[model samples]
Target: MAINLAILGATGAVGQELLRLLEARALPLGELRLLASPRSAGRQLQFRGETRTVQAVSPESFEGIDVAIFSAGGGTSREWAPIAASKGACVIDNSSAWRMDPEVPLVVPECNLEAGRARPKGIIANPNCSTIQMVVALKPLHDAAGVKRVVVATYQAISGAGARAIEAFQEQCRAAANGEAVDPGPLKGQLAQNLLMHWSVDEASGYQEEELKMVHETRKILGDESIQVSPTAVRVPVLHAHSESLTIELGRPMDAAEARTLLAAAPGITLVDDFAAGAYPTPLTAAGTDPVYVGRIREDVGNPGGLQMWVVSDNLRKGAALNAVQIAEGLFA
Candidate 1:
């Protein structure tokens, strides 16, 4: 039987990418439901050459949905995801709403597919976009070498915020090129030519919520309560793709070549580590790609057991929509 699917946040950045992936992957769907906020209701979207009108999300929206992929913000997921699950739909939520909830299993299929099935709430939480890619690249090594600590600094894309944020970055760039004063409205400051250390909503703890999500989500996905994760999330001017510079200290000694070998054999990871050819993973290269790119694999000079590497991925795809879809596919398979 073909799965009946519903896509929440159908008009947003991640939502749009979800639509593109669904088309590219040609998921077996008996019926596709596009759902959005009230403001986006009645709008038409093209899916597989068919025009489908988006409906306002509500409790009744999940009546026949076998699986619901939520790219909507946390508020929307908090309000509607449980309702969808109650209506017998399995919800793959791409929001912070239920990620830390004990009942909702936070998953990166590459690392924790079994945990996804262990969810009693019928809701599976997708890890933060940054966390997802890092874990995918790190899991194989962690299993082989036993990762003890992780330090990650992210160079996130503007699209991680939303389409409006992407537009804001573009407008700022165009204005700069034309020698005009650019207003940074949605982003709160100039995003095109500047980098901001703050990535997401700032919490009272001084760490932006995105960074905190990474620290917590990584631990959850790895099932390692003792693994220490320190994160610094930064918003770069890039339109798509998030890149991370990671340094990991393992419980056992492992050299760069061994780490590279382990990472190469891992699923959903691509090694782009030929610095001699000026070949390394960049945001521009990672944009629109589904796999996580790992490069600059080497030993950390300061720490004997530490390995440093670069990880890049399209935040909208593997980080959010595509990962959620993959989880749903895992369930179906």
Candidate 2:
């Protein structure tokens, strides 16, 4: 069956990716509406060989739309998503505004598809980029050995901040390469030859808001409030993909070899643990890919019941665009 679709933030990065996927895939669509702010209203994007002009989104945008995927920002989602929902569209929001809402389902299709069936608020929240890959890998192990606590450190790409951040990094790189002084915006210092290891602190928890998102979103997605998560999020100069070094403590001891077998067969996860030949998952390897890549699997020497692994995934794909589209598809299923 063909369904009418509306894409909010059509000019944004994730929004553009969603358009590409919608064209590439066999997802049936009745009419596709590309919406953006007034500034981007006249821009044109190609889809299925047709030039579609973006329209300025309004309350009436969702009138006959079946599913609305939003990637604009929290404010837009807060102001417009409910309005779209009220008009009978199922909204898949890719913002932090409603992830923690009791009524909204924060979904990662592979992790929790059933949770997405309810739309009491007519909106489904997507998890943070860092949280998505971590939970996807943790889900299988969590079910087999019971995850108790997790210590994760994420090296997030500048792209996670959006297209402008990547542009800023490029401008800085050009300046530094030519031996010129530069003022890099959106980052503490020159990101070309540096790392923002300590991200801005979240006033409430002293941890970065990025880190807190992982801590809180993980527990909610896993459906286990008791699970403990300590996250340290850092900004790297990379253009794509986010990498995490994870140490997960399980209720029962599981060997690295055993965990590898389970993860190798898990959905949306690819086990790449061939350490002897210098093979391990990295941001470069995972970028532009959909699967969550896990490698460096071993035991945490400090804890007998703990397993250590590295997780890498495209921050834009599985982390953002692909995930939203997956949630949108679940509505049809």
Question: Highest lDDT: which candidate?
Answer: 1
Model 1 agreement with the true structure over 51-130: per-residue lDDT tens digits: 99999988888999999999888898989988999999999999899999999999888999888888798899999899
Candidate 2 lDDT tens digits, 1-333: 788999998888788778877887767889899999999988999998999999999998999998999999899999999899999999999999999999999999888988999869999999999999999999999999789999998999988887677788999999999999977686667889888865557777788888999989999999999899988888888999999999999989999989999999899999889988899999998887789999999988999868999999998899999998887776673
How well does model 2 score by local distance difference test?
0.89
Clashes of each: 0, 0
Q: Give each prediction's root-mean-square deviation over alpha carbons.
A: 1.3, 1.3
The CA lDDT at 287 in model 2 is 83
TM-score of each: 0.97, 0.97
Q: What is the C-alpha lDDT of each candidate?
A: 0.90, 0.89
Model 1, position 184: C-alpha lDDT score: 78
